[model samples]
Target: MAPAKATNVVRLLLGSTALWLSQLSAGTVAASKSVTAHLAAKWPETPLLLEASEFMAEESNEKFWQFLETVQELAIYKQTESDYSYYNLILKKAGQFLDNLHINLLKFAFSIRAYSPAIQMFQQIAADEPPPDGCNAFVVIHKKHTCKINEIKKLLKKAASRTRPYLFKGDHKFPTNKENLPVVILYAEMGTRTFSAFHKVLSEKAQNEEILYVLRHYIQKPSSRKMYLSGYGVELAIKSTEYKALDDTQVKTVTNTTVEDETETNEVQGFLFGKLKEIYSDLRDNLTAFQKYLTESNKQMTPLKVWELQDLSFQAASQIMSTPVYDAIKLMKDISQNFPIKARSLTRIAVNQHMREEIKENQKYIPEFLPR
Candidate 1:
């Protein structure tokens, strides 16, 4: 009788628990539905964009941007009356808030890989008439210019080499097409220095004199320019396939090493360190030469500070050297007596560690670029 009473008590508890869970689940579903309905009413296009954001959260920024751009382009093509306003509002808010939603929208819209959408977004953002001198506006304009150049190059490949350039007859008809107009505005607003380097490239490849003239006119246009400009040339230089090749080689060599063969492991480590040392030496030499040239010629190009150069050099070296360097340093510390060149290796390790810290410190000072 006592056992039966306990079982009845257990059944009652289980029934109550099940009922509570059912109520909780129902409440959650109702809350979610209500939120969705609210979002739909407040921003008619936001629900789909939010859904896209969730789907793309784990993907690369480029892929996410591509997807968002595709959605935007499709909306435009479909002539959805409300979508243009909706998208503009979203972009405006993004620029204003600079929050997760803003970042995600940009990551989905302005990736270097998604050229067309990047351009479109740039144009849209530019059209919002954000202060021309504002940092965010400058970044968007610069990216727009890059996209325009890339797009023009792509189109030029399909166009006849000798095709006549569109003529400008002073009737508000600049040679600038819909695609190139943003670039023109960027140059007009940002000044000649923004595109001075690319002018030569444009001149060399432009299909005709008229095209070249139009490009030159925009690129050389003078304006009240912002004082500071972000330099991406070094970053671009280090992002080549060559760095990836080195990384792959380093990985393979390390992975193929067996713990049983201490000599082979040491040999691999030695080889890697040798390569790293060579790269570091080359970079130091190049930096010295560049500094010398800058001082001698008094070129208008902004000179990199010594620490900046060191940071860049360390970053470049780390691409191929970080893993092997780390392992070698660890091994030496573990068995200092057995390690060859113990003192020198320790010094190198210290330097590398310090440089790593400096790089982290410098990142805080660096301006936030869109892709970052």
Candidate 2:
């Protein structure tokens, strides 16, 4: 064959190969997007428990699993890219896709916990070893700041002075603005959950903003506002949105069994979920220690009894409703309610005036005003 003709043939073959490669890549991309869309559609169909269910009927079907695998694989591809811009583009797309699908996922989780025993899916995912084929599909193993709830409480204590804007001021020391107090209290509650490795991923300001959003709703009621200012809102707030999101996220990483075909990524996710679950279980077991820290923190911040304060205190309470001191007060109140405590000896009990009046009315055996 002539050298020039042979070279032309080689070029022709190369062109054909490139065309075939491009076609395959395009098909993969389309498939990925389709899978993501389908998962989004199917996610809302069941509660999380059913989604995470061991029973075949309760579980997400093979189609949804395939979608998750594609996303997970794309995530791995992004991670493997050394080019920061390219990698980030992949990550951003993955994040947006995941965020859109979050609602359906969350609904399933919360609802299913009621119908079935809480399976430690995160633990299971975390426990699963990666397969050798470069795909395990569900783990994202990044190091997370794993702090105890008490440690988080301490961090908040250190940051108390910075929390001034969230407080309400009035005639008394540490008074809170009632209207704003509930939101701030809820914000504080939300803050507690962010102490772990999962939440440590966000900047402090961003994290605070997220908490504030959640806190805004929990404090809407007069009872809730009063509850917040009277020091009952703190723990409730923590249990409410702030920490709950963190807890829920932690649970999600594991229980959702939505792994991709990349071993490293799957391992990372599994590790994070496993760590989060460990942290959550640890917090649950150390509730007593947390309670002790709560008592001490409250004593240091506000020593006034709930009955001794006037409506003026509400201003102070409201202002600092997001403060660690407020959280301390809420903790004491929660303990008093749940643990069959002697109410007379509760520590750092700073009740706002509205609560005081309610107590007074209650003492007279007047019926509590139930909100319509």
Candidate 3:
């Protein structure tokens, strides 16, 4: 490890070891299968892991807002009996967008070569320290504790989490009768987690005598934010996924006296796409509910939160409150009230603009236009 990374390891080891051990001790059977990470986020209710979720959770959710932005107006011209027609159209298009993103970015989870940063980190740190007197092909994170790494998964976890070890054994049978096969499992968030949570389940499954070697990884957030999507509360869930299994060619037993670094060249990208699909589905459900709410004229709806009200939603609400139908002056006055805050934010963006910025002011990537 580099000096900076070494320093980070030193700090974490010195400062966080106690905290880590305490959390490990505190988890009950069910709670043990879950880890929690608070990555610059605050959720009001359930701390479900999409139930065994991960990041890009925020980044994926942000697409909901972006999807709203691209459409200039709703498609229906006040003639549809089905309130969900517009919502369904948006959902369908959003699904297309999600698919496009996946094909372009996230297909790597199934790639032949494995790439999991968290497991690498865990193993690296373990190598730096200790792994017991003799053990084949597995790092001992803690020598004091028992490691249960085989068995049927009835199962899954939550934690301050990490890198994707989205690997599988390719020749999986329907009965999945492959005995003693090593399985790589990863649980990560944008913040902390523990591989130990998986122990109880794996140990229980092992006792049943149907077993495979398990390589479990629990990770915290990475330095990079590339995987996640962020917008508002509108998009807030990660779809769960299990990656493709490794074929015989991809898995070769190695001895200590060999240089295997040359084969570690392939890169995996966008293992985070399923998380986006989960978020979009969640958003679609919300829009479906919103459409149903619109269908009823006498329904007294709950007041919308500021986070729930987007610029367009605010515009629509303003239009509905107009003195006369489609009054021009009222619309102008309603929208103009936002000028003060928008101007301040725009000024900040302007001040931060570099003389030689990579993306130009009118670039299609963002296509942001400031009001003069």
Candidate 4:
């Protein structure tokens, strides 16, 4: 009787293990196919504005400004309507202008790879450059400017305080205060610099996750691709050693090792290990590919890297925010504060609020201009 029962138990365990393994393989295969499809679709269709340098070579300043205004309007419309088609048109036009010399040259100056050409293209369209006096309506980076860093900091703090409760509650209200406008404007105009500053904090030994949380609140409604691409640049700076501390390698390895035994515990561990190994492998491959991409692409890749990081973060945030969870709110808040805007900080804040609402209401995800 005992031998018969033992045999039965072993059979059951083996059956269960087989089932689990099948599911794991199926899942892995599906995920890979999905990622491949996404890349194939996005890469082929995306306007390679950086490489197509001649598109906007001789566009007049007035025309450039008109294009930029249209881009801004399209971005705003996309935000309001959550429409993918309009955004796609915006990208087509924006890509053309960004490839222009005046617009894209600044991209080379900054270590940023992806959006410099876009910025330079916009610059060329403006009749004027960054105010020679270095005093914009938002931020004062000039030696002649008399605004105190403390004052700017105070304004940021106030804006953050005003927006925090609403960000979590899905009841966002835009700031109308005159002083607060500068803070928002600064964020819009210097988004890259703000982004760098935000990550610089994350890169610090004593990084404050709360600050990142604040900035995220304002930028949360933007497409997921933007966030995903944004973080890739800083991720390059994070060491494997630091990541290893965040991961449990020994347990993962043990789980990955195939279990010859026909038992429940062994089956569970093996299943877990397989999943972890797959994740580890994918990340390793991504990093390897990224390095290769950088070496081959050279300076042009800088803007691409920045955009990639933003897209990564954007994708992650979109999922989190869709759930309307507390972590999502915290993340949104942090993003809002972290990435300083060069032009439209208030707009970003408004967009974040709108996204939060859509997420809470289970709105459908809109396809972005780049089709990611």
Q: List ranges where model 4 is wrong by over 4 Å.
A: 1-62, 65-72, 81-86, 92-372
Please report, in order, the local distance difference test score of every candidate based on alpha carbons.
0.38, 0.33, 0.34, 0.35
Candidate 1 has what TM-score? 0.18
Q: Model 2, clash count?
A: 43
Q: Could you tell me the lDDT of residue 87 within candidate 4?
A: 37
Between candidates 2 and 4, the TM-score winner: 4
True-vs-predicted CA distance for residue 88, candidate 4, Å = 0.7
Strongest candidate by lDDT: 1
Alpha-carbon runs more than 4 Å astray in model 2: 1-30, 33-333, 341-362, 365-372
Residue 265 in candidate 2 has what lDDT? 19
On the 0 to 100 scale, the lDDT of residue 217 in model 1 is: 17
**Predicted structure 4, TM vs. truth:** 0.21
Ordered by TM-score, highest first, the candidates read 4, 1, 2, 3
By summed lDDT, the worst window of 10 consecutive residues in model 1 runs over 36-45
Model 4 lDDT per residue over 61-171, tens place? 334333433333233344355435643454466555465564444334222324433433433322131323332222222112222333444444445435422222211
Q: Write the per-residue lDDT of candidate 1 for residues 1-372, one digit (tens) a residue.
A: 999999999999999999999999999998886311111111111122333333343344444433433343332222444855655554443343355775675656432222232222323444454434422212122223333445555444434433333432311122322333222222221112334334434434433432322321121111233222122132222334553335877776676443223322332312343344357765644543443343333323344545444444354334335447646665544444432222222223323677677777988877665466
Ranking by lDDT: 1, 4, 3, 2
Q: List per-candidate RMSD values in Å.
A: 26.3, 36.7, 37.2, 35.6
For model 2, residues 1-372, the per-residue Cα lDDT tens digits are 699999999999999999999999999998886311111111112222222222322333332322322332242332355546543443343333345365445334443332222222222222332212321111111111112333333334334344333222210111122322212122110112231222333223233442221111110111111100111122322233544325778676665334211111111201333334446766543543343354334434334555444443343333234235635565445544543232222322344657566656766754455554
Cα lDDT, model 3, residue 246:
69
lDDT value for model 2: 0.33
